[model samples]
Target: MIIDVLKNIARFLILSLLQVLVISHVPLGSHFVLLPYVLFILMLPFETPKIIVLFASFVLGLTMDAFYDTGGMHAAACVLMGFSRTHILKLISPREGYDNVMKPTVQYMGKTWFSTYALILIFIHHFVFFYLEVFGFSEFFSTLLRALGSTLATFVFIYIVQFLFYRNDKISI
Candidate 1:
């Protein structure tokens, strides 16, 4: 328990720094924005309680909001993402059903399952975030395209993060 908490703390801090200091600077054209920070929220242990997950997601988004000066968009999107995670998990779960797995990871869930899982959540998150960032219908198509592009970019980044840093412990839930 203590170790998991510490790991989460470090993950939050490290990813936040990467988002604000590094990835945020890269020019992915005008429409797309890189929000690798959401990976922290997505990669959270599958069994994490909803309240804790939502709270952690909010803090993570707010941290980024503070850096990016994007009003409350990040916080709102993250809270929504956190809230939706369990439903998405339930939606995609196998018949054998996540009973043996402790958390979602490429190592435990396999590449395809992890990819689908990441893609769904990342698309939802980016869809909400980009729409909220621009918040109007006049630019709807443009915003939609931006959101789509960012979703793909963010998905790739999330996968890379998992590939490079994720550890598979195979804990029984």
Candidate 2:
């Protein structure tokens, strides 16, 4: 239990730092890089309450908003993603169902399911986030382009990062 708590805290800090790094445009075009905040949400113990997930997402978003000065756009997007998380899990749940030890990863959930799940959530997150940031419909094509491009960039970055650093043992939920 202590180890699990420590792990959770460490994950929060790492993700928060990643959020700042991505938003700060560290790699120039990296602002388009998908911050791996969603990974944190995905890593929570599978039995975590829905309300807690949403609340955590909102707080994470609000923290980002405070840093980025984008009002609550990030917060809103995070909450929406949190709200949709369970449904996505249900949709992709395996025939055997998610054992208590399962985690979201290429190895556990399989590449196709994991990719689809990540892609769908990432798209949803970027769409709501970029659009809300713009707060206007006039730049429809531009916003769509930004959303699609950014999603692709972020997705690739996240997948590569996870593949490199994600531990096989840690993957067991």
Where model 2 places Cα greater than 4 Å from the true spot, the runs are 27-33, 170-173
TM-score of each: 0.92, 0.88
User: Number of the top candidate by TM-score?
Assistant: 1
For residues 1-173, write the lDDT of model 1, one tens digit per residue.
78888988998999999989999889989766788888888778777888999999899888989998999999999999998988898898877887534468877787888888888888888889888888876789898898889988888888877777765454443
Relative to the true structure, candidate 2 reaches a TM of 0.88
Q: Model 2, range 33-59, lDDT digits (tens) per residue?
A: 556666777666666778988998888
Angstrom error of the Cα, residue 147, model 1: value is 0.4
Residue 137 of model 2: what lDDT? 80
- In candidate 1, what residue range of length 10 has the lowest lDDT sum? 164-173
How well does candidate 1 score on lDDT at residue 105? 83
Q: Which pairs of residues have clashing backbones in candidate 2? A: 34-154
- Angstrom error of the Cα, residue 53, model 1: value is 1.0
